[model samples]
Target: MLSTKCPNACIRACHLPAWQKAEEDVKSLLKEKLLPALQRASLKAERARIHNVIGQISGE
Candidate 1:
């Protein structure tokens, strides 16, 4: 389904299959729009996980 809303809105509102079958342009734009936010959110969690592992390895 073509998103009448913008990329960010589509990401929040669309279901998985609808997003998967979106037009190439929509997917591309969504990547551009959301990639940074995804990285920001993911990086913090990953960093904390790595810290936990390092502490475990060092017997901290």
Candidate 2:
């Protein structure tokens, strides 16, 4: 068992297994969800930019 004070100065007991589990969950979430979501958003923004450029070229 480990005890430490948080940034707010509140003392709490920490469990090793729970901490490890939380870390693994965050890693899994980033790998499985956040990366792809960010990539898709980037692609959409790029496509929109290209579309605007093409429209401007055609208008000129």
Best by TM-score: 2
* Candidate 2 TM-score versus the reference: 0.42
- lDDT tens digits, residue span 13-43, model 2: 3333444455455544545544677775665
Q: lDDT tens digits, residues 1-60, model 1? A: 222225543222224444333333343454554568777566555545444433343342
Which pairs of residues collide in model 2? none
Give the candidate number with the greatest lDDT: 2
lDDT of the structure predicted as candidate 1: 0.43
What C-alpha lDDT, on a 0 to 100 scale, does residue 38 get in candidate 1? 70
Inter-residue clash pairs, candidate 1 = none
lDDT for 18 in candidate 2 is 46
lDDT of 1 at 46: 51
Full-model lDDT for every candidate? 0.43, 0.45
